[model samples]
Target: MLKLIESLIRYEIRQNVIKERDYVYVRNQLFNLLRIEPTDQDISYESIGYPSDALDPILDILEEQHILDGSKVARDLFDAKIMNVFAKLPSEIEDLFFNLYKKDSKLATDWYYNYMKALNYIRSERIEKNEFFKTSSIYGDVEITINLSKPEKDPKSILAASKVKSLAYPKCVLCAESEGFAGNPSRDSRDQHRLIELNVNNEPWYLQYSPYTYYNEHAIVLSKEHRPMKINQKTFENLLELCEQFNHYLFGSNADLPIVGGSILSHDHYQGGNYVFPIEKAKTLDSWKKDGITYNLKKWPLSTLVIKSKSKEALIKKAVSILDKWKNYDNADLDIKSYSDDTPHHTITPIARIEDGFYTLTLILRDNQTSDEHPLGIFHPHADKWHIKKENIGLIEAMGLAILPARLKTEMAFVKSYLLTQKQLPDEALKHKDFAQKILNEHQIDKDNVDEILEQAIGEVFVSILEDSGCFKQNKEGISAFKSFIKDELI
Candidate 1:
């Protein structure tokens, strides 16, 4: 009977009727139904409001297994109460609920509890940091600093205009106001900082920051409000008019499909910037000159688009038509099994490449989800640990410092080492090594020497992993294979 109740609750939770926020209430009700107090509580259907008629049969089954007592509840009763709540929920909510529940078996019941804890931590940290900033008179005058203190006033209008809703749970720690403000002062202090604010045809515009920028000059043009709409001729024309003001500029959008990662804003916007290097190198194809439309395929991890026309009006119309087609075809809710058929609008980042005195365009699509077979989600070492004293690990590593490595080695060595020592090398590593060797051969390296170098690198990486579980083995072969794959793909 307890098992049946547990199954029911699980189903309901997955169905969405009982949300994570309501877990406390549900738990309380279960406790009441069981008539169990904190001091001497046990699992039993009778204690938990089971009908008298239903209790006998369940009791008999429990007695047969010697798993129940008249005065105390069965252990499975606790499980059943939770499961019953989930089972009663509607279907739409089931997938996300179950997915999260199954993600960490031991912590399923503590989902809301953990989230609240994280939120409290974020709030406390934000208050503590902001209090310092508030008292620091030296940097208090900047608009960015002021904005952080009053983000609610700004309201992320662009995201709201684009119809992007905040996470249903609440308080997105990923791009919260506190996180943005925390980095504002240093970013504003940079020497090359230039604010490129633009108002498109008098429509209110907001600035957008890029995620993982590959160029010095990168930003997005966003609508004043968070809303969703098809990019029409007027929209494109306005953007094109803005584009003409700068020679080295590229424009892109999230479209209605699976929006690109890091575009947390739901506002209608287009990303653009004046990059230092020739953006064309990032494209895949050599040239895209079909009739009036041109497409330049970009290198891996870079996507772009370039349109040339006799008149801005014509260009805008063409671009709008192309985008509209993509939007219609790439419906997010559709379970389009064939990935190749999916539209590129939201999945790929488009980059405009100019090469050999001609304009070209490139598109770099999202990585294939099926390719990630690792048991753990995509997480690097030290992913969870936050460094209060240092800057971001990415920036530090990029600058050739090993602050993270040193800290992990010294502070977290024991646990890290244990994790690494337990992992068995997956077979895919060998295949990747072979593929890397092929790339080296093509590059005119001696096959034996290349293999030796790769083997040595792999062994060293593995040894490091064994010593510090926090460190992942650097798969040089996998890196080489990825490079080769990208080259071939672009060709």
Candidate 2:
């Protein structure tokens, strides 16, 4: 335990997070947290390449000593508590971020991202274990990640969380008040968390990295207030503002309605990152210039329109105009209704980035109306595709990246074994039986080829899922209908 502690302090010094002068001070803090007395015996400590190298061993000892409950949540909470001692105060981090920003924007972001990982706030070690790969499809290449970074909640932790009374102090996870929060059974610990402040459209916003990063430098730009998400002309303005501020990054928002929006709709936020999605790589099938802005219809599965302009004002104006029109637009033959009774159903997943010195925005049309034949929604992933992914196709998946559930890791292993050995699947993996049969019917699977075939099959399903999210299909009738909407707007 003492060696682990010494190694951690040395690791921080090597990372430049702390100095040699502060080693004794930080060491005493750790000793107090672990309830251990100082040792006069001098110990030589070897350097650790990563924070988890020392942290994992320390956590195991603490668990064995009964200092922490043997649950992922408890260990995670305690580790954050330990690392918080080494982290700079919120004000100090903010000052450092901007001071570096003045020198170079990329340098600032690079340092901040590394600093977060060094603090174990981003959980880099577990993230490295995620199954990530790219697969070819008709609409460019789609990315798939079998998310294993998020630890499954044990039954006892779930029961304890359920028993604890929920508090309203922070309101929600995205709130600015989450900074430095010690956390409870119902909340994630934020002791090592910090937010960098920013101004968008003259309103204060906060920036933070997503703990579960889907892509490189996956970041969340959230409103400072605890407010519901509403997409309007201001959303476009704000999105463009963010893209301009971080010209190298792409920013986007999920639809602001149920069945299409992200999991967190109560607090307004936009997700951006350094990575370019498959949708961005898609080719444009048609183009038109109107009102000093250029609009291109993409050849992807979803009904996406890429709007480009050097003038941010012009693009925002036209984008908002299209948004308002789509809000009340209806097509009876296609079952695309703007509203059913008093509930409106049309919204958009908007993404923005800088391309060749021009500001660009990609808007994906969305609808959430349900029908008798499809209880979830006519445009959502049908019951057939739910075996693989049934969650809302939000901003990330809409951009041709699939964040599949953790169950797929275990389930797919069982599926592979069944296909190879012709053995019966366990009851828990029965959900994939029909999918496996479909794959078997389509392809000849052997031990050598099963893995590649199965991954490609999953990618094909993801393409179909994105197609289901498209308000306008890619068929002749659907394309004509879509072209009609474009033609009408042109007139």
Candidate 3:
């Protein structure tokens, strides 16, 4: 039942019913919620009347409220009692979160993200060192950080695996089961791991620092129960709800499908933190206004629109409406097909933020259409630009920072050497072979400035790759369709 309390506290916090670290208050509230009156000696509760009809959870909204144990109405309560003490683990570093919230509400999340980074907990298992590369671009400065965080299996361990029993104990790395579990061969090392609790739309979701942080204060939001990632009106509601709490942070989810989404589609989650994205910096231009909702076109290559409003409800409504249109939106001329067979080919990666008393959402349209030439996806990175970034341009990349593979560390060095000396490409450098001639054709390079030229070239390549991911081409035809869509104001 400790798992139940841990899960429920996370649920309550995510639901915005209670702030973290208010155990006595939460403990008392539980008395009323679970309908279990505390004994007269239980002096902690009965003073304040919280648990005051917090809204029903997503389960009940779907008409699947589970009360099979003797027909009890849970009143949106948990399955465990907070006061039940039979030697359970104390909250991990949550005491710190509580006190920080008292001094300053935003300080909890701020401190936690910063603390994780300082402890090297964020980069502990994955990155041996932080390696970053940057370049200037028309939109802004484009930075690509090489992630050498992949967990490599030891040769001895791989050989011993057949002799040992493979277990699915924690289910997945993101599961809360790893919160205090010991490390094993198959799973990641989580010795220094920690998760900050957060509520999203009356459901339980957790906010934890991303060890593979691509941006400052980078973090991930995961669901309490292991479930598949989903996108719906509830998702928009949660994003806005979370933005209200973490007013300084930007939160967004990836497309649920592969190719057009994130690396972890199996677990329902969102990526958030107190960092700004380049797309966020793009000025609102060629705009459309309706019901006081400002729909401005972004300057980035990816097809995007920033909708700003003072009314949170109005903006959420607009987002859901636009998402609907984009889901069924069919523009064959622009090569956007919503559905071919039973699979959906179109979706939206929506991001939310609160700025200057107005709520803003950046909606990125995505389409997954694979062709023989571009078998990955016609909307993904093209062949010419594949040498730099061959992976999917998910939420992080969509936000203007590209996370290239670990191989680029060595590959870029070889390319840099080639640029300094006009020597033929080595036989071992096959992946980056043809790419050199293209680079030489684009720029007249010399040793003195070759390094700077290569940096600029990489930034240009990132921009082009993002543009390739755009649902509508950035040319006249694509822009026309985009303008037409907003002009219609489908949402």
Top of the candidates by TM-score: 2
TM-score of 3: 0.78
- Would you estimate the TM-scores of all the predictions? 0.33, 0.98, 0.78
Root-mean-square deviation of Cα positions for candidate 3 versus the true structure, in angstroms: 14.1
lDDT of 3 by residue, 319-403 (tens): 8888888888888787788898888888888898988998988899898889898999999999888888888989989988888
Q: Which RMSD values do the candidates have, in order?
A: 21.9, 1.2, 14.1
Instruction: Please list the C-alpha lDDT of all candidates, in the order they appear.
Output: 0.34, 0.89, 0.70
Per-residue lDDT of model 2, residues 1-491, tens digit only? 89889899999998888999998899989999988998767767888878889898899999999987777778888889999999999899989999998987778788889899889899888889899888898788999998999888997678768877888989998999999998876789999998999989889999899887989999999999888898899999998899878877899998899998899999999999899899999988789887678888888888998989999888888888888888999999999999888999999899999889898999999999998998888889988898789999999999999999999988999999988887999999998898898888888889999999889988988899989989899888887888788768643
Specify the highest-lDDT model's number.
2
Q: Which is superior by lDDT, 1 or 2?
A: 2
Per TM-score, what order, best first? Answer: 2, 3, 1
Least well predicted 10-residue stretch by lDDT in candidate 2: 482-491
For model 2 the local lDDT of residue 250 reads: 93
